[model samples]
Target: MSSSSQEPQLPVIAVVGPTGSGKSDLGVNLALALNGEVINADALQFYRGMDIGTAKITVEERKGVPHHLLDTMDVTQEASVADFQKDCRAAILDIHSRGKRAILVGGSGLYVRAALDVLEFPGTDPKLRKQLEEECESKGLAPLRARLEELDPVSAARLGDARRVIRALEVHGLTGRPFSSFMPQREYFQPALQIGLEVDREQLRERLALRVHGMVDAGLREEVRGLDAIGLRRGKTASRALGYAQFLRVLDGGMSADAAVEETIVATRQFARRQLTWFRGDPRITWIDWQDPELVPKAVQAVNAASPASA
Candidate 1:
């Protein structure tokens, strides 16, 4: 460690919060204050032409802070946690090399952990995945889920749905280890401080509803229509984006536009609740109230205290 008198090494500062809690604004301000660049961890924001639904920040909103990892993937591509880990770490290193801090911002808990924590992503084999997929299709998900319960009860209980069940089995088959064994620890990959935004439940619900309405006004319906033209439904991840999924129902005649809009608001609220649960479970995060008048200054204080001269 260097002497206490020298400037300390820059940490990868992370600004985390639920959707519509102003994470983007806080991230941009933090970057400006800390001489940092923002690295997006939101999975949905990774896709091109996914701006409106994901509530991605515009170039003007970025306020001249260089943002990385946005719009790097096409809607047709799957967003992999493994791939994101590799890319996000590279961006952090590049920023640090250039003597700038890296501010990772997003509400995707798993993706955030992948970027900052000591997380291991199990490798995949195509043949193994295909064989397992076939087994799932032929014998049904019951047997595979039962087998997973026998081997890795943790993952079996946690992972719901056929796809995740098959994935767990694949990990066990290839690595001879339980899929749950790869869960991330709280340990940071490098020096880092996570500043989470805490918002009032009732107020956030109101805010999210208004935000979804604003998206509709901002041509979200048209954006979804255009993406569907290019096969949005075929893109597993993109197709299920919060507003995009409901809007697709509008396109398919299963639901009216107004109904889709209501469902999107509800879905966004539920998602925000889940995000809060995930972040609240982590004890290491230093949280600031989203409505705090001096949010930036408080965040900066947390950052400085996190990595002191002795630290």
Candidate 2:
């Protein structure tokens, strides 16, 4: 018997891939086919009044498919993986109760990982995080990375960079334990199928370039101008978002509009590369080359083959 047979099963289809890889389209198609409701796993897509830049699916795009979590949070409020886990669990239960499947979709690797595993993390201390942020501002992230290298070599080695290293150090300083140790040691939740879209690097780059151009034409500059008026400066998570970040450079006289768009496309391509690297480490994810139209039917088969929930 399947190990999952003992638990109250909730049928979930998780569609994960790098940015601009058609993840949303696949999710929408799956939802339509499976009678499922889409629950967003993209962190950036949650903010209300921040639609076009995030490339959020419109009502027409959704084709009347119900989507949860998108447009659910304030731009200023930070949402964590724990909160995502909680929301996703509740959404899945609700979907099951309605006799429908839950389709979780996005390009955010952390969000996808949290949903796929029973993850636990030390409770955060706002003061400690603030202190760490202050330290980062004053001493620079390099010092924090160096400190983590001394204190938790394993984590430092795993992180291998300033941004992640600083975050791990902050968590360690706050929680009085290696930040890595707090992560769930075992798989608590496993999806029946974890589908990943694989696209050729050149193809992905082309898609990204086109998408960036489309965003510019779709008033992305105006959107960033509005965000600037609201004082959403660089370093704020919202401002650091891919499209907004590049546009900010344009508005600040740092780069020409054309240069900014090209830079954004380049950065987005790099980000997608990192996403592919992250998802590649997960053994459960089944990759379907993006050009393969056979992917959807195969995923559908996987879903249908999943064990039914025990009453």
lDDT to native, each model: 0.93, 0.81
Model 1's lDDT to the true fold? 0.93
After best superposition, candidate 2 residue 187: deviation in angstroms?
A: 2.0
RMSD in Å for model 1:
2.4
lDDT by residue (tens digit), candidate 1, 133-238: 9998999999999999999999999999998999999999999999999988889987889999999999999999999999999999999999998889999999
Tell me the tens digit of each residue's lDDT in model 2 across 225-283.
Answer: 88677665732567788888888888888889998888888889899999999888787
RMSD (Cα, Å) of model 2: 3.7
Off by over 4 Å in 2: 1-8, 130-151, 159-170, 184-191, 309-311
- The CA lDDT at 62 in model 2 is 97
Model 2 TM: 0.86
- For each candidate, C-alpha RMSD in Å? 2.4, 3.7
